[model samples]
Target: MARTRQPEVSNDVTRLITQIRAMIGKGEELPPERLLADQLKVKRHRLRLALETMRDAAELPRPIIRRNDSPVLKSDVVVQGTNALEVIELRIVLEPAIARLAAVRASPVQIAKILEAATTPQGVTRTIGDIAFHKLLADSSGNQLAASLYAFLRRVGSDHRLHVPTASAITSERIQQRDQEHRAIAEAIAARSPDAAEQAMRQHLRRVQREIADRLNPLETA
Candidate 1:
């Protein structure tokens, strides 16, 4: 009698499950299926099977399914009364900690994403790249709850156009300066220097706050 081997798809799913466990912290929610599959370079169906197996084994949390009759909360409803300055204030307090954690916890792939997001591409809005950089740090922190909270903050900032600066403020010199600051933060994380990463993030946010304050009241800065 010949030995029976497990199916190739089953082996792939098992391998993905192991990779995912290594990639994320315990209790961290996996990224969306499509994104996770893309990131792992595995087929979506295989990822789904892996997720299902994990869920059955109590390794992953149960999905949150909403009833059709439940009221869906709108973004505006959830993020009321917040302005740009307030958002920056919250980010100043929150992001340095995220940077520190990213220094210690970020996987190699996450560090690559953080580095890639550090500078704005030609013709893209600087604010968008900045948001992506910060959010990548948050996600790389290995804390899913922290990542979710930071995502909410970013959504609030974007929905209200709170972070976009006026054309007059978007000078080439300022852009270059911001790029340097972003790289400093990213490099600190890559080097696994938690204190340096935290300090760099704090300095960057403080600079942004100063810019926003100057914009809102030019006289005070002058």
Candidate 2:
């Protein structure tokens, strides 16, 4: 199958991603960006790009933050049902455009419903209803076929826990960021600007993908 059009990283960066995948899989912390860059024989900029494009490594500078209370999310069930990479690939193809369409076509009721689904009420388990946001986006897009397909994807995601976000990614800072992103999406939809809505949605999805990588790698500052 053809590869997805993700970050325009060089082959060297791609190789570095694979190498880091191994290190992370083995429960190793990623080296500093400078050291990792040197080890990969790539420029620091290229290394950063690879890390950002690959996910969690971009946020390594923040801190690894081990929590006895909150376990990092890793969906072996979802991974068993289907490839993690494939789920991301599928989302990259379907979601941004669904957001775009929702912006242009969503009724006021649909918009309210979307915002409702995206926000969890106080005391609700954060992990539940993870698919509601994207699923609502598809349904609001005024495309029945797309909505049906997204429903199937939603089932796959919910059944396998693929839609759940990592525990750390829901930190106060990250929550603020998500709220801003969601606000941007809602504003764009209200304004009926497909372009902005699409962009905002894509950014949100990309961030989630990166968070997944971070959970897998759990790279700490070195």
Candidate 3:
């Protein structure tokens, strides 16, 4: 006669994912299950459910995986030579999936951070804000494997667009358009619409890839 309640494992999973992200970012290994459960003030059973979910997502032998130590994969497929194009290719593959997860799993605080980053001012803050906004999406996704791979991709040989002079690449109109695009993606995620979020992210990344291509080959546009 009474409605059955879902096991409280989702909250536990979110908490564990949050802690694991922080720990891995600092190069700190996760403590044993018993210790973590005690520290998190959760029962072992709930903690175990969360731990198992995370373990499956990780699929790694070790708890804390450092970025530098990750194995390099040799792929004969897709664009691989140019750093900028390669980074764009990976974004096309991963960002939409991450956004879809973020739509369902992101916490209130995480959403707030994403919003804040999206609205942050340009100049020095622009670069940092852009980085934070994207990283926060991955963090919100609650998928450590995706998050870690995104992190590694950001650090590896890429366009390093942040360091490159923004004078040419970042025009005033471009900045305005980017703000609108980011807000659209953020809105989709905050509204918890996975399909919308995925589409929004995909559209944004495609625009970026196109811009880079056009820049690299002005003759193509001509």
The model with the greatest lDDT is: 1
* RMSD in order of candidates: 8.0, 20.0, 8.6
Please report how far candidate 3 places residue 188 from its true position, in Å. 0.6
Of candidates 3 and 1, the better by TM-score: 1
Tens-place lDDT digits, model 3, residues 1-222: 999875455765787667765554333335787897888788888777766665554322225555685466532222244457678788889999999999999877677766766664534345555666787788788888888788767655333442222226456677778878888899999999999999999999999888767776777886
lDDT of 2 by residue, 1-222 (tens): 998875466787778788875554333446788888888788898877767765432212222345475534444444566855567667877888888999988877678766765654455444433454555577678777677667555555555444444545456666556656776777788788999999998888788777666665565511
Model 1, which residues run further than 4 Å from truth?
A: 1-74, 161-169
> What's model 2's lDDT at 56?
35
Q: Candidate 3 has what TM-score?
A: 0.62
Candidate 3 wrongly placed segments (more than 4 Å): 1-81, 122-125, 157-169
What does candidate 2 score on TM? 0.55
As for candidate 2, its clashing pairs are none
Best by TM-score: 1
Better of 2 and 3 by lDDT: 3
Model 1 lDDT-worst window of ten = 21-30
Q: All candidates' lDDT scores?
A: 0.77, 0.66, 0.71
